[model samples]
Target chain A: MAVDNASITEVVLGGTRGGPDVKTLREDKWWKLPLVTVLGLSAFVVYATWAAVWGDSNFFYLPHNIISPFYSPCLAHACKAAGDTGSPVFDWWRLSPALIILVFPLGFRMTCYYYRKAYYRSFWRAPVACAVQDARPGYTGETRAPLIIQNIHRYFFYAGLVFNVLLTIDAVQGFIWPTLHHQLVHGQYVTQSGGFGMSVGSLVLCVNATLLWIYSLSCHACRHLCGGQIRSFSKHPIRHKLWKFVTPLNARHMTFAWCSLFFVAFTDLYVRLVASGTITDFKIF
Target chain B: MADVTMRIWRGDDKGGQLVDYRIEGNEGEVVLDVIHRLQATQAPDLACRWNCKAGKCGSCSAEINGMPRLMCMTRMDQLPAGPVTVTPMRTFPIIKDLVTDVSFNFEMAKRVPAFNPPPAPEGGYRMAQVDVERGQEFRKCIECFLCQNVCHVIRDHEDNKAHYAGPRFFIRYAELEMHPLDTNDRRELVRERMGLGLCNITKCCTEVCPEHIKITDNAIIPLKERAVDAHYDPVAWLGRKITGRKKRSADEAAALRP
Candidate 1:
């Protein structure tokens, strides 16, 4: 049967109608996804805010020198010497150390391809699921001001790489515990010594760094960086190989995104507990 | 004799429900074949839209067992031992038993600017093998609207239909923008009017694509990158301001020479 071209044109040109005719009739567990996303993102936001502002217990185990991921590269001059090993590059601001660097990582997550879908559905109700109707009257899309910033995700990916390097350095520092060996050299006595050993804190930081690396590498931006620009995959054998390798990870970008998010928070919490003497760091030789 | 139960949707715009029909199955039958059988033996007036019984035409797209698939491509034997449910694409307004009003897609197509290539050179315009291949991947689109139906931007959000152009046209825009000999600049139109940013790269469109087009990675994301480079990049933004607006390159002008 031939499709009525005239009718199709009439309907096509007919301007925006109201909402959908049917809301949804899906009987199987539709609410679960949005509920989990809302609760998960809300918890992360709350915890991150509290942790950033609490200030005192962010740096723990001064003698052992295991710094929290949140306060790493602590730039405030007022920060205690234990976590301030990176030195205060900008001493003007004495606020929460996380405030300065948190934007980079947070921007990375907020603008992430997967997370955008997660939050858009959960929070914005931009069609919560496959057959569900949206609550909004009109769809403005990302063409306008704030939403358009999402396009800058590739730039955030670049900034995220810098953070990954700094975090990896923190993880390496976890393995080197301070020893009690102080001697006067010139006019100064070195209060701490360093040796290679593993602590539970070190393991936590290591796992955090590893998960983050996987998450960042599996990013859509990174996948695009690897091969999206190439016109033909056959000519550039190396880029083709890299794109193929990243494809599987890119397929599971959502899994890595969530796992890395949970692990980052867990790592921060572990350091905070150890710093506050709430938990003991088990050392492993 | 092996038999299969087909629960086809029977409804219209106001409301509808599933109606079951039991039919005898053959060795290598597809869902469309079964539907055809049902039309022959059981229900004569049972309405559904289809042209080519093959998958190439993309006219027989429907949700088979709750997943978007071409009815002609979905094999009966591949389905599990249960009643196979067939329904019209959920994104559009149901017109009858299994047909949807897909005019929303045509409207979006109309809204996009037509491919405006520069005037041809003396003989004809020359295109490199690589440049042609880049646009070729997108040209394979059959306008199945499966990508449009599956996209949550317009699928779930009914209002989004006005602003968003869905995946089908994103590839169209990508095809025109990526063409080497084409001189029109659609980055601004793509970003502003076409609502390119509405897509968050969920890859839902890619998953449901019958042609296996890389809707998210190749077309959508690259188009997004171009939009960002033209509109957002600090360096590009500075260059645009300093250089004023860009005219067609000398090579592009030469290609258009009569």
Candidate 2:
């Protein structure tokens, strides 16, 4: 039944809700969560920025073949300085390769279903928490303008999978250390492969790649790609199988997201320390 | 046991006010218990709806302490000192004090396509326990509509209510879509007709869900991915064509059936 005549009257709601003009009626420490989120995410951003831009040179360890995930697929001309193979195609590019490669994975995380919530609540304060007032009175969300670009998350997911593959290759290469074999062919000297070996740097890179793979596979888009559209699982057996495998992973996407994020930076730091001779890359073989 | 002051909203669709009531509240008493005591001793004409005070009925839903929660479940002692503000769910039009016109949710529920499983095999359709577990997780929903109340798509935007099915029904769609035996395709329905894209996946719905259903992750996000699979992904489209398999919508499948 419609109560058409009940006049909309302004009154003191209670607690935090002083009135209609009041932002929220929440009495608890509501700001704590958003504040923590801001600090955590901001620290990650700051660290990521430092690693990507300022510490670009120390991202590769030649003896252990440990490559930082941030500078992976080391396609720059400068990669040769670190004893990593450099692609001739990217020889013309002068800047840090991390800048070129980071955009893809960055986009993936920024538009992620979980990250969107984290940043939206913490950064934008778009109704920071339940029943809380929005920072902006009018909420357009991802419905318009720049935020609407989030529809490209699947594209970023695809891009992220490529990065995962590249990182996994880096991890595998981490197991192959440089040999002491020096040969004189004509007038030049060449070093031979150390074959299969391992180091502390190798384990760090391995864990980094593993976490990235888990994060990529556990992605909401990847999970969708598996069995999301299948009308009947009985028909698409392979997809159904893949879907089953990723379902549990997708549930822990948030954990993997944070773990992989931190581990990526740690992998970089480990590589940098070894490359700069700040720390020793102890052989584990 | 202590004296508690409750600032409960009182009024109708037009407007309302937070009317305070001081009542003798026990330590073990719930918000609903206090409201009942107030009704018995203090305010005889206080308007509020309640049933099955054990949190199962899904009634007695209100915004206690500015959080959408079941009044039956919120204990008196859990709340901090001073007045506990109890208000009608902000999402829907208030009918009276704590009651809202949750008929919006009912209308949305009616629009959800029914589960259309393929005809049962002989005696009965048997399934593995692992296959049923996913649906079981979604089945824990008690129709509290707290998810709906907290969802920003409809809660904030009144106009969006026409197109958006909100989180409650999104889970309903997800349940039917993910059902192993079910054949109905709701990808286009949810994406186009039900305004699924309007949901930015902020996950306010998940936060308020009393049943702890992963409404955003398990339900809405999966539905979005399914919609992407059908509408956006060229690879899936080509694969479907090469396989010569066309998944029909509910209408198309229904039209073909006897």
Q: Among these predicted structures, which one has the highest lDDT?
A: 2
Model 2: per-residue Cα lDDT over A154-244, one tens digit each = 9999899899899889889988766746643222354756889888888888898899899989988888778765545666779889998
TM-score of each: 0.78, 0.86
Instruction: Return the lDDT, model 2, position A156.
Output: 94
TM-score of chain A of 2: 0.86
At residue B236, candidate 2 shows an lDDT of: 76
- Please give the CA lDDT of all the candidate structures: 0.75, 0.78
Error of 2 at A70 (Å): 1.0
Q: Interface RMSD (C-alpha) of each candidate? A: 7.5, 9.2
* Tens digit of per-residue lDDT, candidate 1, span B111-157: 55556667788999776665576678797898888989777777656
Badly placed stretches (over 4 Å) of model 2 are A1-21, A86-89, A143-148, A180-197, A228-241, A283-285, B117-132, B240-258
**What class would a CAPRI assessor give candidate 1's docking?**
incorrect
Error of 1 at A10 (Å): 8.1
As for candidate 1, its clashing pairs are A60-A275
Score candidate 1 by TM-score against the native: 0.78
